[model samples]
Target: MKKNRRRNKTKAKLTTYGEFLILLPLCHKEHQTELLEQLKSAKRPAFILGKEVPATLNTITYGQLDDFSRINQEKEDPAVKVFSILMGLSQEEVYKLNVFDVFGVINFVRSELDRINKLFASIKVAHSPEEIAAGVENLNFGTFGVIDWYAKRMGITNQDDVYSVAWIRIYTCMKNDNEKAEYEQRLNKQYVEKAKRKR
Candidate 1:
């Protein structure tokens, strides 16, 4: 009887479809801010619970981009919040999802975020390999920021049209804007330094 009681219980794995359904995360401003903040905050080093340990471990998952529960918003992992936004699943859906499926959901969200990070790889921001890669951290803000950037630079007043464009196109415009800004900054600094030398 004791052995039977102690037996390990088995659970079913996540179900499969023809292909995973993945879409760009919500483009709303508030959603974007929440999503970005979740990813940003997830960077804090994890610690062993109820134990003294150094909090120096830095973990970065591929290409280094980085979520759930309603039980308590304060104590819940950031991923929980992100899942609701990125997966379009409500807290109830998540609560009912299988443990294995939860991981699948988390990975799906990360992949989408990873795709966003790849955009920063070739931008004109950083010089060294490390520096360029560091843009991943800097550019993780939500889509609202990107849209605002395009509007400010391209003089786009038609809000509907702007919002309808594909996320990649919007991101490309942002990349171009960043490159241009860096170039102008470099040019101005050179002139300023030259003037100082002549003084």
Candidate 2:
């Protein structure tokens, strides 16, 4: 029983170390060689398994390369519009993101979407109209729009700030979908009035 437990612990540690090695290449290229050397020096105990361990790290290396290629390919994909909408970034800014930074932003947006979806799901499951109303009131919608409006009013036009402002406005409207149509109509009217004044 003790031997079995020891073997299991060793297997878990090896699996963790293997996963770390697999992800090391995703780091900046300048650090890749040093990381690889460190990985090589981290020795794992060889225990008998049904299959022979591969002699080379070629498979893991290829997987990292494939991920890099996929990220580059995705830059041209129409689905990137979703990221732009979520993050309030322009397509041009999104295209400029480093692959790792893009991955991080994508993950952040995905998690936020999941949280928002769950909130709506809870609102749907409420038993009474009052409960639903309470849920809706508690929902943190429109805060991003307020922030964006304030930022733009203050004339903060730097690229990052501009994107953030846009993102907040879009994200707020998306979360408040029932009001978005009316909100857009109001925005169009405002734009038209501004254009008329300019004429």
Candidate 3:
């Protein structure tokens, strides 16, 4: 019984470490090698991002890569537009992110989702509302990381202020889907009116 428990614990640790390694993104070329070396020297469970799995020439997970074989799609413009509110760094900050810094993470997540199976790809990766919900849940986890990163990078000084704005925008978006859609449609209508006047 004790031996079985030990084996199960080891298996659980390995799985978590494996999944964590799969999800990490290395920022630099040398970071990968450095990570592997550090993991080896410490003789501890660790994951490397942006780096090949140690002792294996095969890069990329076969299962995750094969997920891209299915059809890819896009989401509603309004959904994406409103989603971007939570997705992007606020313009009010003193340390504005560079274009690359701002969009780089977004693009990387897109590409990563592209590699996943069709059933589990991304926001657009989902065709049904239920599927979209699941994908959005996964996407939200990623977005939350970005918001936290921004807070750290900007020296937010007040966690409540940052979190409050995030919750407000998220609540507004989710509170009334129909109303939000109508609001966006109204904005588009006004834009069209302005364009017609210009013509």
- Number of colliding residue pairs in each model: 4, 1, 3
Among the numbered candidates, top lDDT falls to 1
Task: Give per-residue CA lDDT, model 1, range 3-62, as digits (tens).
Answer: 532331121223221111121142456644643343333322222122222232122221
Candidate 3: segments with Cα more than 4 A from true spot: 1-88, 117-199
Q: Give candidate 2 regions above 4 Å deviation.
A: 1-79, 125-199
Candidate 1 structure lDDT? 0.46
Distance from true position, residue 175, model 2, in Å? 14
Query: Which pairs, if any, clash in model 1?
Result: 67-78, 67-79, 67-80, 68-80
Ranking, lDDT, top scorer first: 1, 2, 3
Instruction: Using lDDT as the measure, name the better of candidate 1 and candidate 3.
Output: 1
TM-score of 3: 0.18
Better of 2 and 3 by lDDT: 2
TM-score of every candidate = 0.40, 0.26, 0.18
Instruction: Give the top-scoring candidate (TM-score).
Output: 1
User: Can you list the residue pairs that collide in candidate 2?
Assistant: 88-167
In candidate 1, which residue ranges exceed 4 Å CA deviation? 1-9, 12-79, 126-145, 158-165, 176-199
lDDT of 2 at 156: 62
